[model samples]
Target: MAQTDLVPAARAPVLAAERLAVDGQYLTFSLQGEIFGLEILRVREIIGYTQPTEIPLMPAFVHGVINLRGSVVPVIDLAQRLGRGATELKARTCIVIVEVDAADSAQPMGILVDAVDSVLDIGADAIEPAPAFGSGMRAQFIRGMARREQGFIVLLEVGHVFALDELAALARGVETAEAQA
Candidate 1:
């Protein structure tokens, strides 16, 4: 008589992995004692504070351009642009290079920041919507606010900040004057 094969033992149950709400990451930094962040994908590189070659007739916020490996990129003072007083450059000061596309062009621009903190992995649930209150800076430039142990980091809409349409118009006017000369 052929012996019947023993029935296989039941396998242990496997639990499904819990999905986290937070997905994307942000680069957190400080400006005027307030925290701020930008999506890591938008940030190209970070460099220490350096003297920029001032461009004449440009807006105060436009700190001029710098030669980064043969590429000329404009630098904007985020503090001044947000209506905050000029920030004194400290050892921690840095320039965060951001790539922004314009309506008519696709060139990237660089923005000078006070200091960089760390890269934070924030979930969607961790981000809080910006308040409706009229903050000094335009609401359009805000992506959302992220809360951290230190405080809330104002996440910036880099695309809106570096659009440069207004500045491009002003630059066109100067170009026209030069052409007429």
Candidate 2:
């Protein structure tokens, strides 16, 4: 599918933030050799690798639900959701549990990642506007790029990544693909 079909516009508002106002602590992690960061405020907890129950009629990226302390939380394969293939399961692979703004409520979700990096306090000056094109990701996927000594860590807007509306669209895409197959 084309990139636009993947980056649903319904999710854009989730991570939309101004460069100057985007400064905050972020939790960084790796996905397909790329470093990405999520606003620390959105992260609820980090847990060890575990398989989640697969759901029918859902996108492959929707790895399915896991019982978290009694509550069922949906886990998303962050790599696949971003257009990269599903993450290769490994010792370092783990889930980053996050809470995203869903309409008026805060919905909890899990983000599967290759490995957990570290939490960093990124200043406003360190943030640069997302490039218009050729970032290997949609402009909305990135909140901003944080300048680092090694390079730039793409700051991901977690809410947009897990927006209910966008995810529903992605699920529909999966169904379409399966039907064609």
Query: What C-alpha lDDT values do all the predictions have?
Result: 0.76, 0.86
| 1-181 per-residue lDDT for model 2 (tens digits) | 6434546565454334443366689999998898999989899999998889998879878999999999899999998888889999999999999998888888889999999999999998888878888887766678888999998999987766788889988789878888998
Model 1: per-residue lDDT, tens digit, 1-181? Answer: 2223323332211110112233588888888888888889888899888888998766678888999999898989889877788877888999998888766666657677778999989887777666668557876577777777866778887776767786677667776777787
Score every model by TM-score. Answer: 0.78, 0.84
10 residues in a row with least lDDT, candidate 1 = 11-20
Off by over 4 Å in 1: 1-22, 103-106, 170-181
- Go through the candidates in order and give the clash count of each: 2, 0
Give, for candidate 2, the lowest lDDT window spanning 10 residues.
11-20
